[model samples]
Target chain A: MRFTILFSISLLLTGSRGFAQQRFVLEQSSISFHSDGVIEDIAATNTNVSSIFDASKGEIAYLLNMKDFQFPKKLMQVHFNEKYVESEKYPRASFEGKIVGFDPAVEGLQQVNAVGRMTIHGVTKDVQFPGTVERKGGMLAMKANFILKLQDYAIKVPQIVWQNIAQQVEVTVDFNYRAQ
Target chain B: MMRRILPFVFLLPLLAHAQGDLLDELNKTKPGTDYTIATFKGTRLVNGHTIETKQAGTLEFIFAHRFGPLDGGVYEMFGLDEAFVRLGLDYGITDNLSVSIGRNSADKIMDSYVKYKALSQRSGQKSFPFTLTALGGVAYSISPRRDDEPEGFETVDRLAYTGQLLLARKFSPRLSLQLMPTFIHKNAVSKTVERNDHVALGVGGRLKLTRSVALTTEYYYRLDPPDNDVLEAQTLSPRYNSLGFGIDIETGGHVFQLVLTNTTSLTERTFITQTQGDFFDGKIHLGFNVTRTFQLKKQERR
Candidate 1:
């Protein structure tokens, strides 16, 4: 009976330790987008990005508050939130993805492909992008850049201001994560 | 007994893995709160002020025009031939404080005012049901006194002051309502029986017709009605409270309002207390206001 209890306790401890090794929390993250239109170039950045990764399972997810995006022009920011993005109705944009061939034990940088579903403006679509992940000094740094078509997300631009906004928006994300 | 013990031990890690779902954990973190935006698209809804204000470090240039009463018919080109123009600039000193200056052609009046936001409605961690703002203004009549006056009017007599408490709430995504209690003080009255102090209550609402267009209406009721016996004895028309309805259309950086109102003046002191046209008498003027905003300062990085 004593040997059975000791074996069970060891199994519980190892299981919890292994689970802890799989999860990582984002310590710092930034997501930015840029668009070139006929009239001008528009860009904005959001630093308040939250993300988590399970290295063993090769799973990752990100959450970004739409209102956190800041534009150089205050009026443009208002229009982005009120007219274009309608952030009040959909406050957050998110992504859930699996990183191909992810390994936490690897010590150096590795380029990989990510397959994901991104949700914006209450619309979701499957997407694939290339990214780089580097493991150094017990930390993980991930970076990705991709292009998004606004129409695919059901975001409509009125005819009057059509020339002021580009149909394709370039998005970039960078995250530095620490083991949980 | 050994088989049962081994199965229970294996299930423990599976349970831990299920609990470790990253997306589920992200969702569990408190969601960032969202505040209502564009409660009213423009600063003014019809004849009264709306709760909307410019963001900090932004400036708005406004051009407003009011035409003659529609009763003039085709002879006056349906009131389009005669026009009163008002040019104004509003600057946001801070997110919650703003100042504005305007010049109106009706009385050739120059007006300046300050607006302060006391409270804002929000949801989530800190929630408020309504937004409250306070506004104060003074207008100077630049027009010369009437030639028939027995004595020359003093400069102090040409000054008018107005104070208003504006309360608003966004009841839904497409509807917002506001209540304004106003006070006006004029140093001199046009008629002998007219008092220098007046109080009024104003109600306004905006209903979204589409994503880019909204319908707005406002009405002011005089709490202390003026008793102008001397003016009435001279066959002069009695003053009526201002009433207006309008539509707001928002483009990229501009908001345009097309309005029909019973008052020809754009300043609160004149429109709320000194309106001469009666709505029931078909004495309504057609007007339009255009606002263009510019960002004067670059946003600092966080």
Candidate 2:
């Protein structure tokens, strides 16, 4: 019994894995993107996002429904799903990554490097973004900003509406996670 | 050995946990219930509604123009000399309901209608296979009195009513189809042999070719034509079925659709029952519809 107890204590102290793993689920999140075209500037935001973070191992993943995005013009939203992202074939976009330098026990804001694979329009590519994470009394808040190219995910912009949409877009991610 | 094996027992659970991916864990918490969107791009496919409603606080302005028949030839400048126009405004009272008012210059006709989306196509936890919308409208003609009517006609004689149930499904990202079962009632008809009641079934489809362009076609088949036995000899008009094909080009806030249709009229009461030319007989009219949508109210504040 004593030996078993010793192993259990050792596993608990290791802190990164096993039965003591810390998993946090998203309470709220906002993912927004802006496309600055020559003729028009378009922006959209999706608050209906699902995310979970394994703080113990610094592993994180988030998913968002492409159709959930809201644009200023309703027609723009339709075109985004029906044409740009082909949301019928690919309903959701996701990111799976790890925070390189985030310490869950540290109770202040800290800058971290997030390296991951981002998938959109049924295409996946490696991505890296610098982010800020703040830990407060068992809560974790994260925010990230990055630039993404339309061609990176095979999201084609036809020549006809090329001036209405941009090749490069700026994306912002904000998430708040609570212990599960 | 006991000490080492005890540690192994502790390590076993961690090994199994390590085998799982973070994305798998995220997927478990994903909420269910997703609504199908963009079943059709705009309010109209080519010449009729396509089970689409503007989100609340949206206003759309539609301008439609039809030239004379393409068969009119060079003497008529390929129908450019003849023009019939209609201007309409539609507003969304709610996310699922909208109202529209328009005027057609050809007959000095005024039209008003309301569209309600009773059911939306959806997938996921709760799903529906098709979208269903209820459409009801009225058309009024205010033309000058003719020699046939020495006295002006009664106000009631100028009125016509229409009702339709529109059903549509998006089978794929590239294809969508719609069905409109329509009922129309006219208070007056020039011919006594013509039935005051009209019934028709309209079929429409959209095929996406490029990112911003699509091909759309609509056909309205009349179920009840003027009594064949009573009016076989009386040639009021050809009254062939209405058929149209269009190309939809969408920009950020505008939709420009070019159409080739057999009918010059642009109202539900007229187009569904009064098409005067045969599509195969080279009686096609060139037309275009330009629609611009303005966000009057924010349905969802970003």
Error of 2 at B171 (Å): 1.1
Q: Estimate each model's TM-score.
A: 0.92, 0.89
The most accurate candidate by lDDT is: 1
lDDT of 1 by residue, B1-302 (tens): 88668756755666666675666678779465567677898888887688777789999999999999999898999888999989999999987899999999998999998998888988887788888989999999987756633486788888999999999998987899999999999988865667889999999999999888999999999996876576688676678989999999988888999999999999998999889998889899999999999889888976
Per model, kept true contacts as a fraction are 0.61, 0.54
Worst 10 residues of 2 chain B by lDDT: B143-152
Which candidate number maximizes DockQ? 1
- Clash-forming residue pairs, model 2: none
